[model samples]
Target chain A: MKRTLRKARLLLGVTYAEMMEYRAELYLWALSGIMPFILMGLWAKAAGETPMGMPPVDFVRYFLAVFVVRQMTMVWVVWDFEYDVVNGQLSPRLLHPLNPVWRYVASHVGERFSRIPFVTALMGIFFLLYPKAWWVPAPGTLALAILAMLVAFIMRFVMQYAFAMLAFWTERANAIEDLWFTLYLFLSGYIAPLEMFPPAVREATLYTPFPYLVYVPAKLLAGQPVPALTTGFLVTLAWGLVFLALQQVLWRTGLRRYSAMGA
Target chain B: MHGEHYVPEPMPSLNGSRYAVAWRRFWLSSLAAEAEYRLNFILATTNSLLALAGSIFGLHLFFRTGYRLGGWSWEEALLVMGVFTLLDGFASALLNPNLNRIVSHIRDGTMDFILLKPMDSQFWVSARHFSLWGVPNVLFGLITLGYAGKKLGFGWTEWAQGSLPVALAVLILYSLWFALAATSVWFVKIYNVTFVLRSFLEAGRFPISAFPQPSRFFFTFILPVAFLTTVPAESMLGRTGAGNVAWAGVTAILLLLLSRWFWRFSLRFYTSASS
Candidate 1:
């Protein structure tokens, strides 16, 4: 276990060093992540007139929390996986004893580590900018919220992994990524709350795990508790398991098709 | 990492013959390149349509609840939102989309390719990306404005009188794009800057008046977002008078000239990786 942990540490250092070499390039995407902050500003102002549900103050806290959770939970593994899988890059990973998923998650987690400081500073700004709305929650709530957020990130990344593997079955996997991105933009509480959505649409989301990925954690962080984390975390665990299984299924089916086709 | 940029002194806006030639060359080839990948073009267009639908969906939902937002009735606010879309289309269509890839150039040290050519580097970079796919949104936005205006009870005469200012609003919008795009020199991570600017653009969809009085004040003078979509919509609706139209034109021209100067100024700070 110590050796594995050390190996993980070494991997993260190497990845961060490699990425930092093109720091400006990585910043391009980091900059794109500012979209959530922008949306927060617009909606916060609009909702502040008569808050979304709680109060004007509630909208402020909710959006600011959402932004922080968003920055923390973000990952681009699905995108990288699609590109790599379609290009036959996965073959080398399969050859190795190491699980490729751990490596990919390590790289992403390293990137997220670098970004967390920025979001922490942003939370400070959020508090300074809206003193009345945003505040520190109780220690227990904060702990639960953090755990839910971690579960949410796990849920999101796994779903992304499964969806991205669809590249094996189809060409132009980037298109699939784009489709999922659009869904996340609206459905995952990135744009608006699940509660704000139309009834049927919100109902459909209950079956899907989209809310656990962002909305639930943001809701928790915002002091709302949101359908309660006890249920949410268990559901997130279920979704993650399902996604892991689906990825294996898809890979098996695709590899069989590939071999039969004499590729 | 040697050849990156050449600072040629600006020639007066281009004498007639060469200017006409470049203008003609720009469109003819851009369409050809875009046409080469029909499916990708179709998919890209579809993607843009989805983005457009997202914005429109918000507006539809807002009005579905009530008639007015920020004191402007649904028709008025919707018109402003359409103008926001149109101006956004123009920016992404021309300036922002084109000039934005400079970071890619800087990182790869490939900007030298453009610098090697006799054409001006700034001009070449500014006119680089031509996504004709953005054109439909402009047309669609205008159609939306037309529909909304009819619902709100406005006519062509109102638009004609407002066109002069709406034209100015176009220039201002373009200048803002150019100004921010040039900041690739300092920030080098220009994409995030563009996103932040876009958030302000989103703010312009609703009436400036809808914001708190302080934000309304800041939006007009400090950010000038009010002029981006709202002022144009107001004029084009024939709701505003000549003074506002004149102001839009002056602001546009001033901003345009300012952005060009800043682009030149930023060029001085740019030390390409190749260099």
Candidate 2:
């Protein structure tokens, strides 16, 4: 186990370095991924005085927090999978000793490093854009927010990876992506708080993994301590494990149906 | 073989004489191609319908909770959404098919052929690609707009007063589409600029009044989403004030001239990616 973990770290580092080769393109990719900021402005306006139970500052605080969390959570695995699988670039990834998921995650997180400047600039812009948000997360909650971000990354990665893996069976992965994006728009608080959903929708969304991916961390960053940070973390961790297992099953299942054609 | 292979038969200067025929030929061929895959086309149309429904779902969720969106009555809001959808469908159906190809043309170097053409290249490129697929969305927007008109119960006079604003809205919409399409010069990786453009366009779905005043001022005056939806819709439903229609004409002219100048400027970068 120790040897595998060490090997995994080395492999991860190498794959990340490969992605850094496209550092300039990667930063633009991350900045371009952040369309949620525009939506956040609109929602913040609607929440004037009080937005769906969040006070005015909380509205500012929640969305700005969301801007950062959503940026961090976004993964472009669908585009990657479509480009590779549709174009027959999967053979090399398949031949690697490590799990293909690791290679994929490594490239993704490696690309995230290029995004640091953009994220910092975005936070600075948001602060300048809204100077009245008087609350800040405690150090402890900030720690939990960071942890939730990690869990959220792995969990959302698995979910998007699974969605992309469907390209093995169908060519319309982007159209499929559109459907999932529609769900994320409402369920994940990309547009509005999950709290603002009609009670039934909100209730159903909370019990699922979607909020853990974005909204939970947004809440934590906004200093709205969820009932237990531990609960959110454990839930995300559990979902991550479940998806990890499910991904293994999917990998085996999908590979059996796979036929190789050289690009 | 290299020089002569697949050479076109030169016909009488390739002038205006054959242009209309070529136009007819293009549409006829496209229609034939679309007819061959009727089922796929149907499914794609259904998906766009689903997307339109999703936008409606957003307005529904909001109005289910509140009566007015940014001082818009429910009826007026629907009309704004309807106008937004109409302008959007028109822009996508008409302009995008022609202009969206510019990025690929730049990347692949095929745009040189366009540059060599005698006619206005931008006009040729912008109008050449008719989206037969966009017909459904156009029909869908018309249906929604019709419904909203019925709900509003406006007579011919209102629509008469509304015509200038509507035309101005369409002009501004086209100009904005052209401006974004023009940005392909600086950014080769601009295949998705329209995606970001459309995301901002979604703001027009709700009244600008629905946002705070600062946001309202920016998206409306600067970004001019205000000209796209709220201005025209308000002309029909609310007061046909001097403020709305006057700015509509002025902004439309400014945007058109500026987009034309921008397109000309970007053309300098067109060293033709193709040999």
Which candidate has the highest lDDT of all?
A: 2
**Per-residue lDDT over B36-129 for candidate 2, one digit per residue giving the tens place of the 0 to 100 score:** 7665566667766876786776676556666356767777788888887777777767777777888888888888888898767766677676
Clashes of each: 2, 2
lDDT of 1 at B126: 74
Each model's lDDT? 0.71, 0.74
Model 1, range B1-275, lDDT digits (tens) per residue? 34558665554475665655675677678878877767655665676677667666665544444534566777788788778778767876786667668767766667768778777776777776577767767876787788887887777776776566567777787778778877877776444356656655667767776766666787888878888778877776666777876777778888988988997798778687756
* Residue lDDT tens for model 1, A16-41: 77666655555555555654554555
Model 2: which docking level applies? Answer: acceptable
Tens digit of per-residue lDDT, candidate 2, span A1-263: 99888977887788677766666555555565544565666566666633456555666777777778877877878788868877878878778776666767777777666567778876777678667774668999899889888888878788778778777776656555666666666567766666666778777776667788778888888888575556666766777778677667767887788775663
Candidate 2's error at A141, in angstroms?
2.0
Backbone clashes in model 2, listed as residue pairs: B109-B273, B109-B274
How does candidate 2 score on lDDT?
0.74
The candidate that wins on TM-score is: 2
Error of 1 at A198 (Å): 4.2
